[model samples]
Target: MNTATPWITGVRQICLAVEDCDATIRRYYDQVGIGPWAVWTPKLTNTKIRGKTQPYSLRVAMAWTGDFMWEVVQPLEGPSIFREFLDEHGEGVHHVLVETGTEDFDQVLAEATARGLPPIMEGSWEETDFAYLQSEHALKTNIEVLRRSPIFKGRPEPDYYYPFPPPQDSPE
Candidate 1:
């Protein structure tokens, strides 16, 4: 029973690495009504693979159900962990993201690495920073640390919105 501060905390987003993000979002919508999905092809900055900076791209869809978020990621360009997951596991739950606020991001990441769960991928979308940790062997899934910008709640003007976007006049 180790009470020492845990490496990861506050699981916020569950991400799936998929073959086709749009198709998955549509399936979830048609079958279960899990969406009104927001889709984006973000300009990722400072992307890294296992600590070495590199380039990669992804097609991402996000939908909020109740209090949690479901993210579907399709690797567009790779050498990324997402691509690795798909190659190995054939489209499945890839990671669970930790919602540590910006203030604690560095400290939390430092602690996680110190505890031997170092980041395999690191990148930024808009102002938000994120990292994927090597927690596969121990937790059976990768763990992500997310540092969100106060200005970004979610994509307001997404590249595409499935099941139709909300009316501009309506106050969602």
Candidate 2:
């Protein structure tokens, strides 16, 4: 059903969620050989879900794995559907967001809605217009991906920080 360029751009970033960002980053950092990562956490944003006010912070550790950016996220102080995902399953790949270019950002979102893919997530407010909609078959996937504004393209490649080492003694 996806013929026209659905969003502003194309598939740009891939995100993963982990129970332990430090260990996961370390795994990619040491074991996986992905390094030089960057850590970013967004401030709390208020979103309405099921007619209730929800607050949440988008916490994540991002790194470039070859061409795609691998993001590990943890929901801090909020009621994120992502958190609900953890409760249902576990931390893992959440979403595959396709960058919709900046121009006619509103049109992209409107198109999604008009085309019948109401966005589960957007870059900013509902009025700003630019946003992304999750796939109709998202529930049957390994993760959930939401795209942001396409202003940032060719996101600098990140590094995997996993440099495998000795096994630390477990805390007893």
- Best by TM-score, which number? 1
Q: What tens digits encode model 2's per-residue C-alpha lDDT throughout 1-172?
A: 2436534356656667566677777777777676555655543343543335555566566665456666677777656656766877787776665655563545555566676566564333222222325552644532222334446343232222233321333110
Which consecutive 10 residues in model 1 have the weakest lDDT in total? 1-10
Off by over 4 Å in 1: 1-3, 101-103, 150-156, 166-172
Top candidate when judged by lDDT against the true structure? 1
Give the worst 10-residue stretch by lDDT in candidate 2.
163-172
Please give, for residues 61-147, the per-residue lDDT of candidate 1 as tens digits: 987776688899999986899988888889899999776544377777677777777889999988788888888988899998877
TM-score of 1: 0.88
Displacement of the residue 57 alpha carbon in candidate 2, Å:
1.2
Model 1: how far is 66 from its true place, Å? 1.2
